[model samples]
Target: MEPVSPDRVSDAPDDRFDQSVEALIFASDVPLRDEDVARAIGEVTGADTTLEDIVAAVERLNAAYRATGRAFRVEQWGGGYRLATIPEQAGVVRALFEQEAEKRLSRSLLETLAVIAYKQPVTKPEIEHVRGVGADYALRQLMERGFVDVVGRADAIGRPLLYGTTDRFLDQFGLGDLSDLPTPREVEEILADPRFSRERAQLLAEWAADNQPPPPPADSSEPVGTRLRVVVSSDSPPTPSEADDADG
Candidate 1:
């Protein structure tokens, strides 16, 4: 009799192989490809697990999740199986992750990332030149977070490292590809809009004013009121009484 092929093996009635596949998928941080799952299971069980068997196991696991009303289900993405929260449970999942979102990249880091995303494969100097600020800290933070990576070295005199967004960046931003990123024209239009620009400027101005160093403590020799008068005078045209006092 001919030996049965691994592809012909059936994973029915919740067998050990099926359970192992489920556990692997659950434990994986990123998606697990069928071949990867099959190879891993074959090593542990010393059995010839095939891609077909791994796929069948995933199907069964998803069925079990659905039947048991589990909030998450395994789905194929980026050529592998990953557990994703079901649409019906998205609200609760988002609420749970909102706290984590609070710890997300700051505006400065985001600005630096946007520059790299749009201008890659670009260099750190290019990013800094566009943003008019040093990008060393933001680039380091992005690299630490796995959102950006050094793709290659530029062919310039100094041969600076070329940076680019990573797959994690696309996944984190819910983009299927870099092409899904917003176009430069779209961003330019948004910035050119008077309403949006005015609001942004106002918010920035308010934030700057709020964070300004408390008026350098009034000189010990000057009264607080006199210092306030000086500040007010500098900020606007002095009233006739103030002008006359100044002249006197």
Candidate 2:
């Protein structure tokens, strides 16, 4: 008799398990875990399958696809393996989605995000201290935008809610870690520009106008358009030559 064909011998239950794994990976929204693959295969095959077997099958599949230059491949993400299109194809996929579906943070929102990102596990009061203004509105905007999250509570009295940036934040900012933030001096230099500060203030005003509660009426008992301005510091002393010229 002719030697048994490898193809004939390969058409066994394990082969069927491999196919089921592929299907589950394709259907997952995010990367599926090893246990997920095994559980899915077991459910379909009516036989117990180990994650190790599933992992070996997935590895073979990924290697085959990679060797064949397939447009899609299996990848490990979020502690799970899943089939995903190659990264090069993502631009085309992104183009098909509605532009409005994309989220964007306003300047104040970005600044607030940066602050929380750098000082993560920080409280709202800490944020206000850095900004020198109430950040309640900005915090709400960040929360709505999905950039910042309430990680936990502070250990201090009153147990204020502590906020931190999310994985989405890392994805959006293209940063692998928070340590990439600029130093305090660098941040101060960036914010010291008159134009930059003015633009930032304008952006904050616009964000507040769009999201925050309406301002109190001018007829309210409290005076309106009458904020008391106090001189903080004098400019550098006039140059000696200029002072002498003025005196002359």
- Per residue, candidate 2 scores C-alpha lDDT tens digits across 1-248 of 12222453467865666678888888877657777776766676667778677777777677667767888877664356656678788777677874545455678777777789878889999999988889999999888777788999999999999999876565445444466455566767777778896776676566545554346787777532323321222234667997899779
Report lDDT per candidate: 0.77, 0.71
lDDT of 2 at 154: 94
Could you tell me the lDDT of residue 56 within candidate 2?
74
Against the correct fold, how does model 1 do in TM-score?
A: 0.53
Winning model by lDDT: 1
Which runs in model 1 stand beyond 4 Å of their true positions? 1-24, 34-69, 75-80, 86-101, 180-188, 191-248
Least accurate stretch of 10 residues (summed lDDT) in model 2?
Answer: 225-234
Judge candidate 1 at residue 141 and give its lDDT. 95
Q: What would the per-residue lDDT of candidate 1 be over residues 18-136, giving only the tens digit for each residue? A: 77888888899886778888788778767888777776777777776776788887776645777888888766777877854535669999999999999999998899999899999
Best by TM-score: 1
